[model samples]
Structure formats: C-alpha cells, structure tokens
Target: MSDLIEVRNLGKTYRKATGLFNHKEVIALARVSFTLQAGETLAVVGETGSGKSTLAKLLVGIEQPDQGEIWYAGSQINCSEYRKTNQFIRYIFQDPARSLNPNQKIAEILHAVLRYSTVLSFDQREQKISQTLRLLGLLNEHANYYPHMFSGGQLQRVALARALILDPKVLILDEALTALDPSLRAQIVNLLLELQQNTGIAYLLITNQLRLVRHFADHTMVLHRGECLDYGPTAKIFANPVHEFSRKLINSVQY
Candidate 1:
C-alpha cells in the first residue's frame, strides 16, 4: 500500500483576455495536495469550475503546473519527464466517441497506442489487443468495427481497453462515467473495481457524482474554487461531512 502518486502544493493559473489589451489571471488550482496509493481509488468531487478537471490535467501532464511538484514512484517529474514516463499513467476521457478516432477501426485505434507505447511485435500487439478486448467484454472481431458501430457504453469500454492495454500503474479518469446511463455507470464502476483488484492499478476518478464517490472510492477529496475543502476516508466524509461545502454537495445529490 505504498503511495503511487504524490502531489504537493500543486497550482495552476490561466490568463484570460479582459479586453483588447487587457488580461487577468485566473487561479484554476491553488496549493492542492493529495496522495493516491497503489490499488486505491481516489475520487475528486466538486462543482463546475471547482478545479477538478484542472487537477486531472496536471496529474496526467496535459497541462503544466505554474507551481508545485508531482512525484510518481518516489521521484519528482517535470512536464517533459512526464511526457516520456506517461506510459506508466494513462488518461480516459469522458467522451469516448470524441476520444476515439472515427476513421480508424477499433483494432487500428488500439494498435496505434500499443505501437507507440511499447515495442511489441505485430503478432504480440494483435494478441494483446484481443486479450484486452475480451477483458472488457468485447469480442476479437469487434476490433474490426468502427467507433460509430458501438454504443456509448461499449465505446467507454473500448476506451478502457485502450487505457489498460498499456498496463499502466495509474489511470486518470476525468468525468469518465458521466456520459453513461445509471445502469451502465454501475456496470463500469463495478468493472473498474474488478480491474483494480486484478491488476492493482490505482485510479484517480475525477467526477461530480457523489454516489460514485461513496461507492467506488476508498478516499474522497473535495475541491472548491481551486482549493481543498475536505478530504478523508470516503465513508467518513459521506456519513458526516465536516466542511459546509461538502455537506451541501452531499445534500444536493438527488439520491
């Protein structure tokens, strides 16, 4: 149960144009710190504009932090280092259709990622692709089909297949379950838990879904306006939220 990822005082800022020649700095995240352990799911919950996505971006190296450091496996990493080392960490987007290529077959889409991320031979790549597809409840022949041929749930599984194909130590899911229906969401959540149990891959679940946070996450971190409002064991936070914002968020959930 060692720490897989540690983020310390992480901060990001963006400049937006106020006028023709005027601009203002927007604090997207400020002094956010958290630790994700091996084989654990850390749910990040927040309202819109609360810096959840910004935190995910920084975690996966999609954006550079203006301040603070990110450490993976005991060493600090800069943007460039993260780029090279990112095979150990993978990102799954909310919109599987958009994240996938319309022009390529599913096999081709997976092959592209495998080809660039690993040195597996063609035959090895194909076998790995088939194996991963089956793991996600997809058939080998399904790889010949296009992204448009699949439903939203299937497309999300395809995305998961691609992400897991890398055998990453960490998976950053940015609103990845939001697009699915309730039943599909439950299935995916169960699938995620099963995957973690089997592979020991840690998950950073960036979501606004408090129910998922309660069910799937071992720990929960609450963010508001680019700062940490509350963070602790998911059960404790849900049962008795210490922060007013956390209480409001939990109360706002319809179920």
Candidate 2:
C-alpha cells in the first residue's frame, strides 16, 4: 500500500506569555516522524499533555507545527499549505458540545456542511443526510432536534454522521469516542471498522484507549513528552513493548 499520510521531523512549540520582554517556549511535539499507508488505521496513544492532541490539530490544520512537514499522498502540507483535495481530510473533535453548534438542529448542521463542502443539490443533500443519519442509528424524528436536546451519545453519533456526509478519505478522530459509554463505544468502533472495510478510508485515531488500540488499530504509536517512544504493528508492540512508557501505558489501561 502506498503511503497516504507522512510526517517528517515534526515539531511544535508554544511561547509562554511574559510581562515585559523575555518569554519561554514550551515544546509540544519534538522530531516526530511516521507513515500511514492507504486504508490503514493508526492509533496514537498517549497520556494527557503528551502531544497527541497537538498532533491531531496539526494534521487537520487547526494548529501549525513550528517545524516539520505533513505530507498527504505525495505533497507536503504545512500550516500554510492545503493538502491535495484537502477538504476530504475530516477531523472530528473530542467535545461534542464545543465542536457542534447547540443552536442548530441535526439536519440543519449536516445540511450546512453538505451545502458548503459538497456539490450535491438540495434533494441530493436531503437524501444523503437521511441516509447518513440512519447509518448512525439515528432516526428522522431526531433530525430536527437541537444538539443540546440529545444525549452525549446521540450527539457523538450525529457528529460521526456529519463527518461521513462528506465522504471523507481520511478521518482524524481526536478522542471522539472517549465521552461515549462502553457499549456505544464498541458499536461505534464496529461501525468504523465496517466503513473502513467497505470504503478503503484510512483513520488517524488519536486516543488514550489502549485496549481499543490493540484490537482495532493496524499500527500504534506511543508518545511521551512530545516524542515518539514506540511505534510498530499493534500486536507486536503490545505483546512485547520495547519502550518503558509503552509498557506502562498498556498496564494502566483497565483490562
């Protein structure tokens, strides 16, 4: 399989605020490199403040890396460059409340995205929106409901449906499943696997869920203090972790 996403010598630093003149810099990601092949699912596992979220932001062009290159397909995209057909690189943020508009109905929210990003006509958008909602196990009756009216789990499903409406080639899910219950999480995971098998879409799963990583991810990368500590096939890495941080993270997960 050809490489779909590539990162080389990636680095990000945040400057701390100072009173008068001098300020210190906090490094988020330091010299990180990896390759994600087409149709492959790579899970980025890390604890809080370990640069996992930072990596996701960089990939989705939310935050620019101070140093490094992000290559999609064959071209490199930085904070300044848009990936080839970049709109297909969809990002599902962690917080449903924050990422979604509370004032908009589910149908309205999805329709707006489809209208702006897709070329589908009004009738086509309606049909596609309804199909996506059903695929997510949501009914048309819930379509007119505002986001705040739905439960957390429902909001998450809606969010996933919105991402799918674009027919994305690469889905960057940043802790998107963390807020869900275990049962719902399993269902969503299964849905993701099914979608991948059917569409050949790749995923950059940014999560701290170690067990899920072992089960669903083809490749796994562990981060600590803004650096990659271990990366390899999921089974091999978990079966015998070479890095101490990887071992500890695996152990920390409730089995």
lDDT of 1 by residue, 104-158 (tens): 9999999999888889999999999999999999999899999999988899999
Report residue 247 deviation for candidate 2 (angstroms).
1.8
Summarize candidate 2's per-residue lDDT along 1-255 as a digit string, tens digits.
678888998999999877688899889999999998867999998889999999988888778888888888888775556543446788898987898888888889989988887789999999998899998889988889988888888888888888888888899999998878899899889989989999898999999878788888999999998999999999988889899988888987777
Lowest lDDT sum, 10 consecutive residues, model 1, at 78-87
Error of 2 at 123 (Å): 1.7
Number of backbone-clashing residue pairs for each candidate, in the order shown = 0, 0
Give TM-scores for every candidate, taking all chains together and pairing residue i with residue i: 0.97, 0.93
Local distance difference test scores for all models: 0.91, 0.87
Model 2 TM-score on a 0 to 1 scale = 0.93
Off by over 4 Å in 2: 78-86
* lDDT score at residue 6, model 2, on the 0-100 scale: 88
